[model samples]
Structure formats: structure tokens, C-alpha cells
Target chain A: MSDEGIDEGSRRDGATELLPPHVSADFYLWLWWKSEEENGKFAIDDGRGGVEVYIDDRIALRSTGEERPSAVLTGESPATTPEARAAVAGGKVPRDIRLYVRRDDRDYHVTLRGTRVSIAQAKLPAQVKSGDVAEVLYDRMFLYEELHWIVACLLRAFAAVRVTAAWREDLVPRMARWATLDEARAGG
Target chain B: MGILKGALSVRRYRVIGEVPEGFRDLWIDTLNSHQFREPQSSTHKGEVVGWAQAHNLLDTDFTDLNQWLYDRYAYFALRVDKKAVPAKLLRAHLQKRLEAWCKANNRPKAPAAVREELKETLEMELLQKCLPRVQTWEVLWNVNDGWAVFTNDAELPNERFQKLFLRTFGLRAVPWSPLDELTGTEGLAEAVAAAGTTDLRGRGA
Candidate 1:
């Protein structure tokens, strides 16, 4: 009825009918990696809550309450074995590792290995934005600290590079600032 | 009774019971001397009455009053004992009447072959209407089947859109599952391709 409604209707019709199905899958993976690198960590603390990182199905590190932690983990190349390749091609990962974190009483999971995940592919009930990666990472880190009562500052530092590498190429330069900040904060 | 008498102007009929105000126009005393008797003529009159009754234009007994009217009108002079009817049967009779009317009027009839196509068209329309409200990335992520199970986020509250997505795509909103974590664009591509292939198969089938 309204102009906006008409426009939206047309846009959706075009998107559903014209847009190729495979679009955005590769972009999402690239974006995921780039965002990871930009933040230098998968999770961060903003004087309140920090992030937790999981690598290869293991809890890699967590940030201290004093600072947020960001974590990133890259999966190994796609499984090469016949069986593994079959599973991957069938949308199942036989040998991939997963990352899971609990923060603010909520748990979030990301895959560290194998196939790239998409909201559509993962069958998640809601769409995920690039911004959510940082937020969830922070929350998971916070939960890791509270629940485990262990320091993971070094692991957090190690995972930061993985997070940064996931960002877009243009954002790489700004990531240096993030790295510097991480170092300074770690030293202090 | 008073309204029916006043409305229909029949002298031989008696109102056995009162009909609801909404069903008044639908009720008629079959035994009335003014009743028309030709089967076809009665059927046509019954149709008018049935339409009125369906729309709740008159108030009267909720019993098979519509059918009673149709049968009486269709036969023109049906026995009074045969007049009492059930509601569900009355509804079916009314539907038949409507179908006949459509045929007579040369309106498009819904065929079995076109039913699925019609449903798909309606579903697509609903989805398009819902697109803008669901523009956020979080919402989009939850749009798929397996992904929605892992991410327990709420969907946009467009009932039409929700129904369309659920019915057409087998999508449901649920908490995010661990399996979803391993997915990426490649998986999505594969899924889309699979869906496309299935669509083609369905067409051939």
C-alpha cells in the first residue's frame, strides 16, 4: 500500500526470483575471517564483560575481567580423506572442530574447522550480523572467566591474530591499532 | 416467528422456534401457501437463502435450516417432516450451491493441478511482503531450517509471512544447534542447489 511497502515487495520479489542462490556464501566466510582479524580477538571486554575463545573443540583462552578478550580460531583445510570429503560435501563435517562459549547465561558456538558456516547453512533461527561476532565472543569470554575462574590472557593474545585475519582487506591496516592496544593493555 | 411472518407474508406456515437475528432472512416457513414449488425454482431461491444464512444476514434456528430451505426450495413442495436439517450438512449444501453458481456465472474454478501453483504464488507474495521487516542479518540467519534451531531468536511477527515460510520452506524457529556451526556459504550454495534440483524434479514428477 505505502510506497515503502511497494518498494520492499518489489525488492524481495527480485531477490527471491533473480538473485543467484550461491551468492553471499563465500562473502560471509571472508567477512567472518576479516572481522576476526579486525578485533584481534573473537571476544573483548569493555570494562564489564570479556570474550572466551575455543580452538579445535577446546577452550583455548579467556580474558580477564579487567579487559575484554577476543578469540579466533581457523579450521584446518577441508578434510581430504574420501570419507571426510563425502561428509563435507553432504553438508556434514566428519572431522571438523567446533568452538562453543557461554556468556551472560547464553551459549554461542562457532566452528573452528571444516566448512564455513552461514545462517542459512547452520539453520539458525535468526540472522547473524557481523557485529554479533564481537558481541557473542565477548559474552562467551565473560562466561569462561566466571565459570572457570582461570586466567586466559595469553590464549586471548594468541587468538587475536586469528580474529583480525578474518576481517576485510581494507580493515587490515586498522587492525594494527587493535594489536597495539592489545599489547599495551596486556603489558599494563 | 413474527419477523419471519412479516418478512415472508406466508399465511399457512407457523414459526416452530425462533431463529437468531443474524439468520432471520435465511429462514422461511416451507408450508406457507406462498411457497414456490418448482424444483429448479426452489433450488435457486434456496441458494439466495443459503447465501443470506451463510453471511448471517438473518437470525433463526442453527439447525440444517439452510439445507431445509434449499431442499424445500429445490423441490418446491417438500414434506414438512423432511425440513429439519443439520448445520454441517447445511454448510456442505451451501458450498454446492456456491459451486453451481460459479459454474453458472462462468467464474474460474480452482482445479487440482493449479492448487499447488496457487499456494506457491500466495506464499511467495506473503514472503515478499515480509522481506523489509526481516532485513536484519540476525533475522535472515534464522530463516533457514537447521540454522533456526540453533539460534533461538524471534522472527518478524508477520503472520502471513511466517505461515508462508513454514508451509513452503519447512522452516521453524528454534534454538541454534551445534550442527549449524559447521555451515558456511558453500553449504548454503549446496542447499540452494539441492532445492533447485528438487524443484525441477517436482516439476517433472
Candidate 2:
């Protein structure tokens, strides 16, 4: 609001604010890296505490047990990857968390930080102005929710428990209406 | 930080308890009630108490205090306006006054009582003029999903927002953590729920 003051784009520890992922490593890797299943399914435990899903040996997702907890899926950091780490060590500026999501044939590495998230295409540049976090969030929220939809499906699959069942009953229809998934909120 | 731009530094929360009917009124009333109030020096205490207000982000005039639900989202800009007279500023005034009192009273130094008196007087005279800092926070509410995102990654603003939200909606917001993802599968949801475990996954919930 101050006309002259510098804007602190995203607060410190941007990576810490996301909800952890609750993905299955073996199933996730197979689905993510090898298979072409439209549902690319995994298990979700709507249990107490945060769940860490090792999508692969390299990337993992951590989020709250509650369906809508804040921090969405996060990937292994550039610091953890040998090549990326070496790139940083070699003075190639390492960004924040890089989430690799395979859609169709190509894989997309979505980089995320405190208030930063972007689909990194080596051709086009990553998000530059930190102030653009809001717009970027607007664009990418569905992507996170898309992953969450899978998380919800996984939660439903784990519905042998009482809580997931209740949620199943509450949500109505075993699965989310993915046809207009992003637009689902509009009707509601 | 400066009202979310391209990125949304989200503080995810799970809404506990069903939303009360006519949440629209509750939301409006609460927002109006908490809108920033101007600071004033207390004539009795001779001190200026700090005050905070929320304002509009886009409207530079800051008179836009209305709410709307469009595309299943209630879009609004939250700008928190706060003003405080730092202790050091008050202390500096006290220091100068103390010296003057000592010189006039023919004493080596002013006593605690006299210092307090001078401080009280000085605050009344100068504190009201101190300007406050303004911070803007953009909020997006997915009424369908029952979760909202603020364009900030701050502990204080987030906490304040939670308090205001509960007061407005009569529902609680648990800051989304990695732990929230694993809750409610079966007995675990019960355990956390029964224990009233807030931030069971840690982070000083």
C-alpha cells in the first residue's frame, strides 16, 4: 500500500507453506513414468497427521491429512538432484522445488517456492517477477487441484475406514466430476 | 507480500464445523466491523493506542468495502492498515524531556515518577501523528471447496485472518500442513479430532 516501499513478493520459507502430498511410490512411479492410465491411481489415507507420498525414489509429495490442507504436492529440490545440484554448484542459479508431472508424452517440471509456482519449459523462461505470484497461482491452482482430485480418488479407494467413507458420502458420487473439474466450483 | 501477484503464497486451512446458514451476512458484518479505525491519543492516559484497519487493494480511494460472489468465488482485496508509535520514539522524547526537567528542577536527573509524567505528556502530544504501515493481502475463497487462499506467507497476517474468519463465519480454520493430508482416513481422523489436535503434524500449531 505504501507507494514507495519495496514489495516483499513472497515471504521467506515459501516452500514450507504447502501441504504435503499423499502419493504411492510404486504405483505412482508406474503410473507417472510408465503407464497411460487416465486415472493414474494411487492410495490416499485421510488419516491424522501429514502424509508423505514417494511418487518415485526422487520426487515425493507431502500434504495434510485433511483434503484441503494448504501446501500441495512438492517435489525433491534441485539441491537433492545430482545434475541440478551440480548445476547450482557450477553457478547455475537453482530455483525452488521442481515438480515433474507427466502429461501425455512430455514431462513438465513445475517449479514452486514460497509464493512462486511455474511450469518450466526450457524454451520459455520461468516466472521472473516475484510479484507475479498471484497471477501464477490463479493459473496453476487447478493443476494442484487436479493432483488433489487424484488424491481424493485415492482417499476414496482407501474408504474402508470411517472417515473416508463419511467424506465419500458427503461428497456424493464416488468420483469428482472431472469433465469440468476446474469449473466445478462455478456450479457449486 | 505486496498483495499476491502471479504467485499465491497459500496458507491452506480445513474448515471445521458446517458453515452456518446465511454466511453471507456474517461475512459482511464481520468485515465491516473490523475495517481499520483511525488511531487517536487518549486524553486520560495521555497515550496513543495502536489501531489497524483493512482496505481495498485496487481502489486507491479505499472506499470499496463491498463484497461479491462471482464465479463461485468472493473476490476481495485485503489491505491491513496499522499505525504504531515505536517505543524508541517515545523513549527518545522521554530522554529529551528528562534532561529538560532536570535542568529546570535543579536536580541531577528526573525521578521515575517525573519521567513517567513527561512520557505521558509527550505521547499525548506526538504519538497521534505517527503514521502506520499498510499491507495488502489478496484473498480467494472457493466456497465450493471450503478453503480460501491468501496472497501472503506470513505468520501474523495469517493468524489474524483466521481469527477474523472464525468470528465472521463461525467456523475454524486449521492451517493446512503436511499432516492434514493424512487425517480422516479412519481412526486417525478420530484421534486428531478427539484429541482436538491442532497442527498435530507440528509447526507449533
Best by DockQ: 2
**Per-residue lDDT of candidate 2, residues A111-175 (tens digit):** 33221222122111123334343354444455444444433443334323323444334322211
Collision count for each candidate, in order: 71, 49
Locate the minimum summed-lDDT window of 10 residues in model 2 chain A.
A115-124
Candidate 2, lDDT over the whole model: 0.41
Predictions' DockQ, in order: 0.02, 0.05
Minimum summed lDDT over a 10-residue window in model 2 chain B is located at: B196-205
Q: Which stretches of candidate 1 lie over 4 Å from their true place?
A: A2-41, A44-50, A53-101, A109-188, B1-159, B162-205
Per-candidate TM-scores read 0.20, 0.50
RMSD of 2: 14.8
TM-score of 1: 0.20
Q: Under CAPRI classification, how is model 1 graded? A: incorrect
Question: All predictions: root-mean-square deviation over Cα?
Answer: 25.5, 14.8
iRMS, candidate 2, in Å: value is: 16.6
